[model samples]
Target chain A: MSGVRVILDQDKCVGSGQCVMTAPEVFDQRDEDGIAVLLTTAPDTGQTDVVREAAALCPALAITVRE
Target chain B: MTSDTVPAFPMARAAGCPFDPPPELHRLQDEAPLSRVRLWDGSTPWLVTRYAEQRSLLADPRLSADVTRPGYPFPAPGRPTGAQKLGFILMDDPEHARLRRMVTAPFAIKRVEALRPAVQKIVDDLIDDLLAGPKPVDLVEAFALPVPSLVICALLGVPYADHDLFQGHSRNLISRSVPADQRGASFRALHDYLDRLLAQKTADPGDDLLSQLVTRVQAGELERSDAAGIGVLLLVAGHETTANMIALGTLALLEHPDQLALLRDGDDPKLVAGAVEELLRYLNITHTGRRRVALDDIEIAGVTIRAGDGLILANDIGNRDPGTFTDPGTLDLTRDARRHVAFGFGVHQCLGQPLARLELQVVYSTLYRRIPTLRRAAALADIPFKHDGAVYGVYELPVTW
Candidate 1:
């Protein structure tokens, strides 16, 4: 669980911004459309739990986290 | 389930406990998380009462938000079911996403955060008006309704002077007991009003949302009718939902003095933010469940839902689900209640949530603190609760300082 990778499916994203709210360090929404943009594909150990929570909270199921 | 066994949809909340969801909803969640409930039309839609199931099903592509769909459960009889009437909220994605995205930038978290100072100013000015005005003022009129209405008016480019036209019609639109023709008339009134306003914005574009919508229309990215519809949605929802939350949240806080003390005495922004989420969770203003229809067969909790089956995600009780929140009945401001689905769960979840949150955070943080002696001017029983409306709140909250 040391190295965590996050993938956001832009196609499935509905721009709910739950991921951005939940894990600001790992996700940021594009200014133009509010679609989520991954700040880091690989989140550090401290950010892993919140990244997982963001993935769980994403309404569109657009965020995927692999550890 | 047999008709005799099926409980009617939109069950009434217990007497004297206006803040709680219908007791039957809690029982259903405890006993059968997914069960059938009879609607006004004698149609039984599956009522998903549990939090996890609701979030899962709401996110499922198999469910469609199109109001015109055959099995879609209308809140009441005689209500119009036009998907265009409320804009993209009643439509599913590709289309929902397309129309919703056009206006998304304005309500994005960052954009809404920028609105905090303006909202705070509005709250402060309203509280000033309340303090200066006669004692025992109707908070709904003197404070609650005006806050969101003024903010939305500025944001949507709708004139605050025309508040009566929009507010009156919106009142008719959300009341479940309103006659169908009256409701239809109200819908048209707001629709036509917004249409005319959009036309005005087309001629003299302003630095607001409707004007931005006009820009999309000129670029051929959005239809004029659709732009009007989006205006109607934003106008009605932006004001009605948040206004009710302010009044209702204030009432809830007044009843719980300790909670009020925590909010009124605390200087921490995090404490205020948590209180807002807890209030949103505890007092789910949208009590009439989120209505939807199944687009494809789905199986959940050992129940097989047919493609045409209608579904109601009762997020009020879902927020109260014991599995999700411990001691769900209590209103603890300190509780980590952010996970609650008061605004709902899924792509079609509240688009105005950021704005709503910002407004509530400002009000909850500032109001009680500013007016430390704020109390109910009328007895709780004398207060008119909006039990018949699609949104739950007080019609008028009389308050004194």
Candidate 2:
């Protein structure tokens, strides 16, 4: 396990889906409004790099990751 | 504040290098990353030239994209600002978020990925028409414009036959040199057209974007005028930006046969996707920098931007910042150019980017391979570039196989 804690601030998310596009395994968008929904709060070791990438790529600065 | 010290905004590109950004922007990036530049109205806004500063400032909540605010730099003297005409995209948060969310589902990554096959079909059908058409056809008119126009029409349920009505007005809307009254008239025309179309969708709805908006309106979730405004924004932005990228990307690729051959002969999907990103980073269709005004006093990079100060986030030069990308001037297709701000950044980052990427990927992957001998029929100097328009692209690309 990566022991990575990911927090998504829905209020701040613009729903651009940069996170979902960057790390699909760890994130997805709500079907109703396209707001991001986390698929997993703690990503595996293999998914850590891409999860961090999703956090960085997010335009709204909505994603926060604690390693 | 002297004219000699402060260079004017929208600086001209080099005479021979139509693909590169204005040379002055490069110098500004090197000497002073954030410096003042005069707009058409004699207002000096801070022009952000470096990539790092652009991304951070664009994402800063203190910088407002709302054009209605005072000191918001207008690209031209009397041109109608986007906030005056377009909805959501030009507004600030809360209100911007409310309107933007109502139509976000259709353009979500999953939703757009599902549209890949359909987008592929659109590209394939257009290429078929191009192959059958006469030699030396204007690719801009024949292929580039129609591909996105057709796809957007199908998505929005706007009849493609009405393209002439919308496209003509769209041209007027984006042109900086167009008279203010003429541009206002174009805005009204498109707004009224979409307004009526929304009414029709209400009477007989379909499984398309406008109908979706109609549903929101009926449920008391959105206003009719705002719905129409969103329609106009999506319709105009959907086609215009992509069409330019298509024609200009083709021109760029043809100019570099080595890069063109890499895309043409290679079948790897990753290579094709990387090529699309590189082209977007290089061409930067939105040539006029992203405009904003500081809502609160902010300090960064050893400078204080007072409230009401205007800013021009020059993404064209920012994309070419050597600090971010290696050998930024060279058009290398294989480089990891994903961080480029060609699409702009922050909450206002392009909503339709997934769709844009899907369309470009399909076209870049399929076009060159299908038409191996696709070469430019016109000389570089003879081709007309879109210097007058807000977007940067060639006006017409004449090509022959």
DockQ of each: 0.67, 0.82
Per model, the share of native interface contacts recovered reads 0.50, 0.72
Going through the candidates in order, state the TM-score of chain A alone for each one: 0.94, 0.93
Q: With candidate 2 superimposed using the best TM-score fit, by how many Å does residue B307's alpha carbon deviate from the native?
A: 0.1
Across all models, the iRMS values in order are 1.2, 0.8
List, residue by residue over B350-374, the lDDT tens digit for candidate 1.
8888899899999999998999999
What are the clashing pairs of model 1? none
lDDT tens per residue, model 1, A9-67:
98788777778778898898888888889888998999988998899878788989886
Best by the lDDT measure: 2
lDDT of 2 by residue, B1-401 (tens): 58767898889999999999989999999997799998878889999999999999999999998878899999876645553459887888988999999888988899999999999998999899899889899999998999999989999999999989988998888998889888888989999999999999999999999999999899999988889999999999999999999999999999999999999999999998889889999889899999999999989898999999999999999999999999999999999888889989998999988889989999999999999999999999999999989888888999998
Model 2, C-alpha of B162: deviation from truth (Å): 0.6
Model 1 root mean square deviation, Cα atoms: 1.3
